[model samples]
Target chain A: MAFTLDEAQRIVSIALNHGRDAGWNPLSAVVLDAGGHPIAFARSDGASPGRYAIAEAKAYGAIMLGMGGRAQMARAEAQAYFMGTVNGVFGGKVLPVPGGVLVRDLDGAVIGAVGVTGDSSDNDAEAACAGITAVGYTPEP
Target chain B: MAFTLDEAQRIVSIALNHGRDAGWNPLSAVVLDAGGHPIAFARSDGASPGRYAIAEAKAYGAIMLGMGGRAQMARAEAQAYFMGTVNGVFGGKVLPVPGGVLVRDLDGAVIGAVGVTGDSSDNDAEAACAGITAVGYTPEP
Candidate 1:
């Protein structure tokens, strides 16, 4: 089944909640379905204006590459030249950072991805995973 | 004064509420500050994936051109060749059409712009004006 809008909003809400509870900086969260289209997005009240774009790009890259942010970072390191070309193609939207988390269904199929930005990359990824797990989905981070 | 995030979110919320109350199709709303960066955005559950992009572009164009969507439309008609080059410079984000409304402060200075989509252009513009007026700002459409 395709990702529902409610689920996407819930993911964003939960991710922001996690950030707030942890006393992290204001956050932005974006949920993208398997098709690499945003299902829902939100930026916290104090988040910088660019937060939404960064969060969306993180999720977009994760969903498009079929890997979590860490793996993308590793690949970016291993294949710098190729990644440079890919980043150009994606219009610099492929940020290989730790804030992107892949969501998986019971059958281990990729369903969508969640991206959070504001705090450090590790905290961002932690918030993303928290949201995915709260929604009863596995997070590949 | 700069636009606050709370005001932006309220605009999106009220715009979507107007669309629902009018029984129009699912809609997307985007609020961009004077600097042409999004402060808040939302797409109704059934809105198509591209709604966000369209809504954003509409508001971006209005804010960048210092006019409402109707004025932008007129400019597009009168200066199609120039508009083509301008659109290219903005990376095709200048959608000169109805549904974009300029938000003005009490002193009549442009503060921001709101864009709504997913219905007829007239209906979309109506919804955007509703939200802006509800927030006590004038809508220049």
Candidate 2:
């Protein structure tokens, strides 16, 4: 089944709250279906205005690559030219950052992705992982 | 208060359902906050792949111009040069069409905008108005 709107909102809520509870900066989170289209999004109070787009782009990247942002970063680092070409094809939607995480269903099929931004990349990734777990999905990364 | 994610999704849900109930084509809807940043989005099943970006651009046009897409289209038709300049300024984010409607709070302050795409422009505008009304917000045009 596709990632439902309720699930997407739950993911965003969990991620943003996790970042707040951890004393990180205000965070923005986006959930995208497997097709790389946004399902839901939220920007926590006080988050920078730009965080919304960044988070959505990160999630889009994860779904487009069928992998987490951390893994994508590693791959891009090893194949810079190929990655640049891929980025151009996506109109720069792919962000090789730590905050984007792939979400898989119980059968281990990638269903969607969660992207968090606002704090350090590591903290953003941590929040995304927390959200994925809260939603009973595997977080790839 | 900013446009919350919940409200954005609610708007999308209502708009999509309205389109479906009317037996229109599958649609994509996007909600942008007052600052013209996307807060949430959804693409209905069977919608053309291009609807998402078009919906976003329509909403961006509505918010940036502080008017509904229909009004913007009217103005654009009257002043093609000025409309071209505006489009250049926004890097083509502005789409002068009937599908984008401004959202306002009870106090009549602009809070966000919603755009619907996939059907005829008139049908899209009707769907957007239904969505805004469903979310207890004013739908301008």
What Cα-based lDDT does every candidate model obtain?
A: 0.84, 0.84
The digit string of per-residue lDDT tens for model 1 on B1-141 reads: 666766777788888889999899998898888777777777887788898889988898888888898988888899988777877889888888899898878787779899899999888999999888887788987
Candidate 1 vs. truth: CA RMSD?
2.0
In DockQ terms, which candidate is top?
1
lDDT of 2: 0.84
Which portions of model 2 show Cα errors greater than 4 Å? A1-6, A20-23, A64-66, A73-90, A104-110, A134-136, B20-24, B76-89, B104-109, B134-136
> Ten consecutive residues with minimal summed lDDT in candidate 1 chain A?
A1-10
User: What DockQ would you assign to candidate 1?
Assistant: 0.47
| lDDT per residue as tens, model 2, B1-141 | 667766877888899899999899988888888988877677776675567679988999888889999898898899988877898899888888899999877777889899899899999999999988887777985
Error of 2 at A134 (Å): 4.3
What is the alpha-carbon lDDT for the whole of candidate 1?
A: 0.84
